[model samples]
Target: MRSVGKQLDITIHRPEELSVPLRRAWHEAMDESPDYANPFLAPEFAAGIGRHRGGAQVAVLYEGREPVGFFPYERNSFGVGRAIGLGLSDCQALVHRPGVVWDMQELLRACGLSVLEFDHLVDEQKPFGRFVTGTFASPVVDLKDGAGAYADWLRSTYPGVAKTTLKKERRLGRDVGDVRFVFDERDPRMLHRLMEWKSAQYRRTGRMDRFSRPWIVDLVDHFFQVREEHFTGVLSVLYAGDRPVAAHFGPRSRTVFAAWFTTYDPELRYYSPGLMMHLHMAHAAGGHGVRLMDFGRGDKEYKDWLKTRELRVGEGFATRPHPVAAAHRLWRRPVRGLRNTVLAHPALREPADRLLKSVGTLRTSGRTGLERPAPRTR
Candidate 1:
């Protein structure tokens, strides 16, 4: 390990180079702070991403002989760095022991990064937090209530929809057979079905289907194989008798389950399977030792229904005053700003949504052999 400082020495290593003892220290640091409890911040998650992405590395911070912190990032050849897994990672932070502070500029210099870009940076990261141009609300559910919590919360918070949703579940169960939920489904076939459903949902909603990209597919497959104590790929499935109605694939830490991808069979849309999937997962996750389920940052009806609270997540480039950093910030900020503005206002958002759907329709019009589902019911 090469030292980058006198008092707070920093040593960089490829994700694979992180030893067993260093990993234990990293986990120990995470246990010291609730903000670092996210599975995305774990060494295992970094290792998973590193396996797929060549630039993944970890910078270990040392105070004398003991390790004090861990910083995981992806640095390109041009010295452009991003949070590990960037677009895919929901939580980003340099996990460190409490009261341990370091200069961002010095850290950047040590890692040979002119700027580090992050969208979902944990709020406790004051040094990086200051560089954030905007902060967004990442909704989360407190699972301390567990089991019967979803029904109770729904009845209390959304009385109108509560009866209707519960009624639909009953009707669905009767028509399709007994309803069941698998908190950690191990079926490989179900994984393929989930990808198909999610890809179709993405097209219908005019969102980019990540599965279309081979790297994302490979990365997800790699993550599916992870079974570390700190990071586990959980694929929860909702089934009615023999049919899979909905599925969600995400990584879970001991205390936090980071919601990643969820989609329902369009044929089962009338039953609100996607909503059911989340409610079921939230209820069951508590039994599996999860205290929180992070829904990530975004405005969604489901998030509104399920979130017990919101956490502030920052987005921006943490830099050390370099030309590349300036150029990168200038080039990226406006696009993000405009997108946020459009999403914030319903007047603009409605029109944008309509346009996107129209494009999606045109794009999917000529594609042959896609599964044709029965018409969706209200």
Candidate 2:
């Protein structure tokens, strides 16, 4: 990509064609940011997606022969191209140098996308012209310095809740066997068990089991083995006596732990093992010098009770450069409108949830094939 004056010259390239300089520039810029700074936006993730799904595109934004930004997205075509695999991620955006700015509309136009959809985009990006929707509350726990300070902060902020949870922990130890917590469990076997538990949870709730997708399952397995400072797989398990009661698996940065998947043994429900695990994770994260625990986008009573603040994320589409792009937008208008209408009514939410549950059940049960075995230990 070439540049003219102050505006960047943006060009769309296949993931394999991304220049080394451009990739380096993107990571360097993203590293300096204090936000989630998720490595999912990095080239490694791009490559992983490319391996799982073809047509992964990397948009290079440049000015005066200098690489400035990178936008990595998958290209989906159903008449027109859309952003690849957007709905499942927590961080989305172009990785750009600090203080560098560009028009998102211009970039999207250049990349030939018909719609640029994002569900977990950071709050700072200004390219999308409209605010599409807001996710439920995302709970975050500060983990600056070490776990001790965070524990003190928790004691001060939610004294009763903290006391109660801690008491439960002690009681669980007395009633059950020894209580043990594993921060970064490396056993792939354990990961498989976590997936099995999560899938079972989804089935019990009549929700879609994401683990059914081979690509997603492979992605999680690949990420679990990946151990980088910025983006590492974190699997925390709480064991009572010799049996595992609760576990959580997700990605973590130096200062942020994104809570992705969580489940607990139903037999130990009285101990509130899930909540106890989070309490332990909070302390562990703080001790590790991390600063935030993102519970992802969802409105749960637990999130509200645990989190001290919230971050806003917006969603919308960016069209491709093709002629059909306009038609795609026009076609999506009604769907967007209906979605907004549903979101506006609290009364309709329960019915919508039920419908989603039904769809999930059908989707999971419809799958017919030999699948991998569940993990023995998690």
**Which regions of candidate 1 deviate over 4 angstroms?**
1-6, 145-161, 367-378
Per-residue C-alpha lDDT of model 2 across residues 79-102, encoded as one tens digit per residue? 344444565666677777777787
- Cα lDDT tens digits, model 1, 66-179, are 999999999999899999999899999999999888888889999999989899999999888678989999999988646555678657645767898889888999999788
Q: lDDT at 274 for candidate 2?
A: 83
All candidates' lDDT scores? 0.87, 0.70
Best model per lDDT: 1
Q: What is the TM-score of each candidate against the true structure?
A: 0.93, 0.83
Task: Compare the candidates by TM-score and give the number of the best one.
Answer: 1
